[model samples]
Target: MVYDEHESTARFLLPATGVTIDILPGSEIEVEVIYREIFEDGVYCKHGRNVADRMKDEAGAGGSKQVMNVKALLNVALGDRVCAAGVPFTLFPRHPGNSTLNPEERIRVQRGIVEPYFFEGARQYVVPMTTLSDVMEERGIERVDILKVDVEGAELMVLKGVQDVHWSRISQVVMEVPDIDEEIYTEGTIASVKRVLLITQLLKKHGFMVITEFDPNGKNHMVYARRI
Candidate 1:
């Protein structure tokens, strides 16, 4: 259960797996150089803390700041769109996909990379976005066998935030899609098509059985739904 829209935290090791990157915000050398280019060589270990402080010391919990309070770490009840959650829609400088800068010091700015180092005093965080029925009703989590998603292109806002009666308890799903055809309005349609044909018709209208695997050269695709 990791959600990185940026708040920052890290911990990893692969050969003998173990990873934890709860939240992401930026610059700790941009979160240890983008997960050390996606893992390898001293496999991460930023720590930084308060990612619930182990369920708030196993429930002796006093005012959870599992991510800066306000019903954070979920306890629900947030309306008025959570008091207009940050309105800075777009200005993404892009590097390691969601970079706010420090991609090797914005490539050691010679003369080109200086636009306030991609937001010198950048500030815009709203973080409190959850779904998959608010984390399977806040972690009672009956089932989710597998649900690997790579949010580079926001993969259909994380598969339409699951909930067609919890998409039949989610058997499997391995996302990372974006096979081109950009039009992006999705559930409202704006035209062009192929985001692997709208995530293989939204997991074949929920019954699953989808299977795409592009990248003959690279538009990046890899959808594989199950529950058939």
Candidate 2:
């Protein structure tokens, strides 16, 4: 069996070596192999960025942390108006829920699966999954404290949109980085380990400190970070 240099797919040069290795082209094998390779090498491994370095960069940013999740934002507000760095701001819930059913149910019915609830709160703004940076820029908010993103598998796109944002005020971030294999391949979503690693590196360069991570029971991983 041979894996490609890009690591996108593994080909079985010679049939089973009696090892019966499940050759899941874009599945668990991909995640394990990529992760192991990165672990063995340093930051600039075959992948790219390591978790530790990314966290450090996030911490060093000077921006006002913007909590992307509506529930989290509400919790921070605590009955008081939303304010970051003395700058009064409005809370924007990207995908708000409807009154007919729970948010989780709404998402599940929309996706045709019993998935977890990601967004909650009043309908403030219905932004596309890939236009986070555009929303922020349009709002004219200079400093974003923490962007608590939990968009099922659209994290990569969201991160991509904000690639040019000033990292100083966008200090901290907490996102759910789903299992590349399960979420993307198995579930037929547009997620990949390569994309995740790319976004991780971008965050690292900006000064965020990736602190905690929760692996999916059998599906995804949640990465939490803070600005130093």
Candidate 3:
């Protein structure tokens, strides 16, 4: 599930994933073309491409009327491990680690690049996962307006690599957390229930405020925040 926030204060949730722009009264929208980049993670099934295409369509329709240049970092996985162990196994932008892998099992999992099932199910395989900081450093990006994180259960680990200085450059963030009753069990690991609280606390500590927490979607919780 996806939710997008625009300028207009349309008080209803549409329950869909598409690009929409709302030029609200008394609200100002600005578009700058100096190195416009859209870094998309979890590019499984080219979901990010679909989103970018939608954004382009919206932009052509008299929205973001500035001569904007768009760049993207789509489909590059963002996590600690390419895959982890659990009921069926898990995949990430990095290797989940071999702390849980047995001698024989590890050998087989390490043979070749782990591939994800084309469908919506988690079929175990080891692959390569990358990090946001690494990519940003490579591109010499000093600031990130929006950082959207949707790693299955390794969100915290990813955030760990972001230095405090980088926090100052980041203006907003959108992340997924597990629901209170729901537990994220993957790669022979179980994420803590305080995951959301931890994320909220950390972001707040870094000068960001948790402005919006979407209604729990039975499976996970979505939190949107901005620097204060």
Instruction: List model 2 lDDT by residue over 62-114, tens digit each.
Output: 35553232332221211112223332212213222111212332353345222
Candidate ranking (lDDT, best to worst): 1, 3, 2
Residues 2-30 of candidate 3 have per-residue lDDT tens digits of: 01122234222222334454322222211
> In candidate 2, which residue ranges exceed 4 Å CA deviation?
1-130, 181-195
lDDT value, residue 76 of candidate 2:
20
Better candidate number, 1 or 2, judged by TM-score:
2
Q: What are the models' TM-scores?
A: 0.24, 0.39, 0.48
Candidate 2: lDDT of 149?
59
- lDDT against true structure, model 3: 0.49
Better of 1 and 3 by lDDT: 1
Q: Give per-model CA RMSD.
A: 18.6, 19.0, 15.8
Q: Which portions of model 1 show Cα errors greater than 4 Å? A: 1-124, 135-150, 153-174, 177-210, 216-219
Clashes of 2: 27
| Superior candidate under lDDT, 1 versus 2 | 1
* Candidate 3 positional error at 89, Å: 7.4
